[model samples]
Target: MGLFPRYKRAARVAGAAILAALLAGCSGLGSKAPPPTYELMAVQSFPRGVGPIRGQLIVAEPSALALLDSDRIMVRLANGQTEQLANAQWEDRLPKLLQARIIQSFENGRRLRAVGKPGDRLVADYQLLIDVRAFQISADSNTADIEIAAKIVGDRSGRIRAARVFKVSVQTDSTEGPAAVAALNDAFNRAVVQLVLWTTRVI
Candidate 1:
């Protein structure tokens, strides 16, 4: 009878150990690793131009829809619904990220006498107003599309001097996050190149 009680206790201990191991395994299986983060590439140097635009130019932060404003990488589905990529995210909020890149693009051109933001306190000749219409990857076709509307306004007059829309699309080689990001970068670079060229010409 004494041995029987010891055996029962031993059996209970073994059962508890087995249950604990099973629970740990289940927990490990349920948890998933987070996806990788990616950043937008800056256009370091633009093609040399005829001359720098006179006076300071302020590049305002681009306005975007709520969906495009986030750091999550967006994808447009065939069904017309927008979704985010599973394991990838942008380095920063989309608008702020694009604003920095645009500023960098202008700096790379070296064709602006002075480039700055709104708070720079520089006497501005013109302000670049940007509206981001679209910036997303297409899940169906595995492509990236970027569209931006740019307007140059005389700072003092507050009148729009020149306005144009820029759009570019680049096809991705694969459906993976890296491929989509690469395509997005290519499309964004193309748009920036065109935007800089046009701005320099008009302003």
Candidate 2:
């Protein structure tokens, strides 16, 4: 028929236009700005170590759910749904960042003769196991909540020594990226401070 070739030509033109649009969209995505990066907060100073530096600790990378494990900052809505905070991310994966900060906190506290990850090869007295339960801005981003369970196990005996959960909440002044993160930092600082105090007292 006379019309067949005409219809085929139009279809080719339309397909070409669609392909061009998709390529443009992909290019736009590739050109988008990178998200801002943030670091986890750590306790700066701690009460002087008691009698002597006795305990050696190995801080394991924390265990976390996939939802909380990503570098993306998360906010839990009042409706109990979670969403990533727009345009911001962590400097590293959540567990990795937290683990480093925890080691810093311990070293700063000076209660341990040595502290490091499993790779450190320290002749450790105890190993610290951590499980991250929640780390997010909650209640529609107006509050920061952090929770973690920690356990001390005898490195030589492979026996549990002590265990406890730590949790803290700090009210946010604003849900904006910087302020929200500040609040989270405050909460995390509080939690780690308590964790340090407890660890020193126990072992």
Candidate 3:
């Protein structure tokens, strides 16, 4: 009985030591792990159209977000100090996001009979030309802002129906890439809403 008790105590001690080692290993591994992040991308869609139009609208998408070399700023790090990260590449390789926002705006207006890409088969009467001017995060504003120069042109008549530059600044609560994107998205939604209303009145 004495030998058995000693053996059981030794096993219990061994198990406790093993568990402690495992937990210690896990803590060290977990501490060095990075948070979740992703390569920011864009998406496009249309809304509020009843039926197709006589002509199709084409949207030209840009390939890269233009990072502003002169607009870099010191961002607050997790350590509570500050660090400088890249600036002004929000629209880079994100043409889909822009195209989607524009399409939704026009669709909401219900003025354009049809909307499509450049190669689409639908015959279009008016084409929308969009230039993303300043879609980036501003440290000065502590948020991201989106500015797009847009124009509506008659396809058959080759006349400029409407032209305007839309700009909006949005503040983000997070300091991560996703937070920055969310800010841009919010600004984009507002811009699209206003643009749709404007298009409805004019065309």
Among these predicted structures, which one has the highest TM-score? 2
Ranking by TM-score: 2, 1, 3
lDDT by residue for model 3 over 1-203, one digit each (tens)? 67999999999999999999999999998884433332332223435555443345655553333442222322444444444444433332356656655675565455566776677776776777777666565655577666777787888798999898888878888545567657766777777776665655555
- Any runs in candidate 3 off by more than 4 Å, and if so which? 1-56, 62-92, 108-111
Per-candidate RMSD vs. true structure?
A: 5.1, 5.9, 9.1
Taking all chains together, the TM-score of candidate 3 against the true structure is 0.58
Per-residue lDDT over 1-203 for candidate 1, one digit per residue giving the tens place of the 0 to 100 score:
68999999999999999999999999999998867889898787777677645557899999999999889889899999988977899989999999898888888888778888889887889999999999999878778999999999999999999999999989898656788899999999999999988888887
Tens digits of lDDT, candidate 2, 62-107 = 9999998889889998888889988788899999999999999988
Better of 1 and 3 by lDDT: 1
Worst 10 residues of 2 by lDDT: 46-55
Model 3: per-residue Cα lDDT at residue 2: 72
Question: Alpha carbon lDDT of residue 84, candidate 3?
Answer: 41
